[model samples]
Target: MKKLLFLLSLFFVTSLYAQVEKVEPTFWWVGMKNPNLQLLVYGKDISKNQVSINYPGVKITKVNKVANPNYLFIDLSIDSLVAKAGKFNITFLQNNKKFATYQYELKAREQASANREGFNSGDVIYEIMPDRFVNGDTKNDFVKGYPDGTDRLNPDARHGGDIQGIINNLDYISSMGYTALWLTPVVENNASSTSYHGYATTDYYKVDPRHGSNELYKKLAEECKKRNIKLIIDYIVNHSGKDWWIYKDLPSNDWINNYPDMKICNFRGTTVFDPHKAEIDAKGMSDGWFAESMPDLNQRNPFLATYLIQNSIWWIEYAGLSGVRSDTHQYPDKQFVSEWAKQILAEYPHFNMVGEVWLNYPSMTSYWQKDAPNLDKYNSNLPTIMDFPLHNAIPTAFAEGDGWGDTGMNRLYDIFSQDFLMANPMNIMIFGDNHDTSRFYTLIKEDFKVYKLAMAFLLTTRGIPQMYAGTEALMTGVKGSGDGVMRKDFPGGWAEDKVSIFTRQGLTNDQIEALDYMKRIQNWRKSNEAVKYGTMTQFAPQNGVYVYFRIKGDKKVMVILNNNNDKQELQTIRFAECLGNHHSGTDIISGNALNWTNKIEVPTKSAMIIDLN
Candidate 1:
């Protein structure tokens, strides 16, 4: 009798260990062969659970554990499971008592494939801060815990732009000939004020409930792909919001870059590549806070680095993005950054990524590009970078000049001189204004002619062009010295708005002309092969007039910019080499015959493009 009691006690203990409390499943491998499918599962009190998966014409090869202690990884190594995809039931048991049983459905991997097809591409990328673009849906304008509601009336507050709004305006973007869209961080920003920009990430895995959802972003990619438009997600690896989820309950002390206490950075970006830099300076730059609210990430921690890298990969595989735009490029650990870029590119070889190295100097910027000859000889695989050197110079050149120093068109002269540092100039994204700066119109004090001239050069330039939202509409909202006003909502996109550029609802004559001109130039850029991949040559500036030509095998485009207000005329013999033996051509803008000879005439404060056929 005592021996019988001992055996019964052993059986009871085994039964208690195998009884699972609840099974919570997370990621579903949308589409895989029924036989080869691997379903990762998370459960509460499931350590010793007896699990079995059953399906018609399908078999489970094994069950295992993932990195987490509370996971039951289900693996099916069937070769013919793709054809038999439908639904399968699994049961978890303890002794003879059933603990849990549920049906798991197998659906084709539509979302995963969407992410793969939508984001990888070779095209010009336009980055938009959705909240500042247009308000297509105002129903989601307000949420609890955040009092700054939709304020189309306030230029500094939420403008009510959402995913649906972006969807509504796809035609306008597509009409402009842009092949891809890179939106700023759109995850749920639960901050009390100024959360409209969506940069301060509160959660890494969850989409900011305000913008939409993880699924909506996938839908955005799907919508874009149908129209041949790729999506480039703007990612921030440098820091998170002050109240990030991990901040309250970190997995480990080293999970964050500079956790527990915030370390402010010196804003010294050059130190990352400086060979003689002090160890403390480098550490501060990588682990320092961008601002009081922004908590910097410490990528040096192995787990943190791996987590960030895997998260980035998950998004890429999840969203099917055409590319990625890394924010605060120099703030993260440089070694880890190299690994991040390498792993990302390794996963998707055709995918391209551009880093934001907001430096005004080319020498400082070139150190971040891939294969650049560095003092440290670091080989990074990041493919592209923002052209800040050129971006800054264009405005200065168009602005009324000092006639000396880095003034007048010489600003353009000095900026392009550094093009030799770039491995591929075509991949460089050139822009006049972005979400973080004063609008071009505001910067030039709303001068229409200056804005036109600036647009002409930006579209015809040698880099991938990125125009800020509302730039075409001549929207002039300045966000002050800190760039709070640079991003304003599009008129008439919301129900309360009075004007709409799409239908020309409330535009001035000048605004209409500007919008039409932008459409024309952008579409022209999309089709012009010479402009896309041609050799460029420029004649020296004369009285603020700069002339350049993009030449291919037999295709040549002569671009003439007149920053001065006075018009000038001359014979066309100056560009004989580039002009070839042709004596006549057509001005694309004016549609007038151009009698090529010793010199050519250009209008003052105007730009002309000559189509040499």
Candidate 2:
């Protein structure tokens, strides 16, 4: 009887022990890989009071704790480990008990963006603020401490669009013929209400939960590469969100710029180049917070600079992105920004990056472009810059008759004349409207004719063209335009929406025509290598008409835009000389044969593209 009772007790004890299972963390991430393989592992587990890591061959170099209590951080050194594209075994233990083992695969550094050798001069970038683009995943839309998104109907509030949303609509973007896509910052934006824009970054290393997980972001980049679509991530180095991790309890007092007592910048970019300017404005440009909610970063501080540089490199390596577009380019320390670009370009020789200068003057804009002969000698390694000077010219040109500043043709003539100021005029990003202003459609009063004219100029113009997300369908909204209006749910993105552009349902005849027109132009631009890397030459403006030729070797594309109210005739002789003796070709738009030898007639407020094949 005693032996039987003892056996039952032993059976019960074994069963209880089996029921208590150990759980391992779900998501794990590492960054800033050195040859020594220093890594910071971040993960979460339900009941991990203590954690330890184990790996064969590779050394367990260091371990640390992260802010979250559920997370256990581990570091490893792969110095002695040989690299081949294969998996290695790693284990995690808690309190002397085995919890989980992972098969960590190692490979040579992954390719971010495409091989950039021939990439710089040819690609047209389409910049989309991801949160405002689409809401593919509704499950993780609202996160705690961030905005509370109970209503998808409100644009001023969080709208649940995420990285998964962009991934879901890869086909839509690809079909539009855009070779590259640039998304606004996707890092963790924990601020509430207005965080949807993603400019106020609370965490640099983590993707915002409201947007999607880091893994999902990586997947988006991978999927884009498969479609031959390049990804350029927009980064904000000027300031961080008010409630940033470092702001709450900084690793050090100087971890942030002007820590404790926030500072306001003078917003004087000219001072950086001014011969006799006050030191106050120069300091303010580099150290002043963009807004009270955003804290400026001190790039002059070596530690802060190192942290930022490493963070950027980590993302490029991790996601394999094609390029980077720096936000508020002139706001940071000019010297530091130069070094930042230098370090990144050194690591990625073929990589291309463009900074947002937002300067409407040609001289101010040209100062940032690489190799520009600026009197200040600001040798910024950055290769490309946003061409606001050209952007400013387009609207005034298309708006009414050619008066004082209203001459539509004069805008282009005046702006292009200053092209000598640019280091590489072909590399400038030319666009009509962006997130900060009213939509192009709203700006032009929803006129398709005017819109198409703008499109023609952008597509055939001398710079890398970037069309804002809704520019195709004429998406419009005023800034502070209430977030909902700025990023209206895509026509057919949501199941509840009445129209879906994807299926061509619920679109009017004109809307459908406009859509088709965009599709045609984008597709045409994709294969025209001459337009991508061609040299442009222009003839002096004549009677409100402007003509230019994009030529590469034997291939030539002549663009003639007539902004006048009445049809104008070109004497053919003048443009003939600019075309290098070619007198006849086919009109790309109408498919009509062109008689460029004797004379050329262009309709009022219309443009013609001729493929001189």
lDDT by residue (tens digit), candidate 1, 442-519: 877888998888888877768777877788888876656445555666776777667887788989999998988887
Model 2 alpha-carbon miss at residue 309, Å: 0.9
Using Cα atoms with residue i matched to residue i, what is each candidate's TM-score against the true structure? 0.83, 0.84
How much does candidate 2 score in TM-score? 0.84
Q: Each prediction's Cα RMSD?
A: 6.6, 6.2
lDDT, candidate 2, residue 44? 44
TM-score, candidate 1, is 0.83
lDDT: worst 10-residue window of model 1: 25-34
Cα deviation at 57, candidate 2, in Å, is 11
lDDT (10s digit) by residue, model 2, range 1-613: 9999999978865543343232222212222134333333333442353434444445666555544444333445554344344466455556766555455565455434324442365776777877666778877765666655636667667666678878998998999888898998899877766777788888787898878888888999889988899888888777788878656644346556777788877778777677888887777777777888898887876646756776777677678888999999999888888888887787677888899997769988888977778787778888999888787777777876565653667778789888888888988888888877677887777877888888888888888888888678766676565545766656776667787777778877777877887788778888887788899998767677789989888888999888777898888767656676776788767778876566888888888988886
Evaluated against the true structure, the overall lDDT of model 2 is 0.74
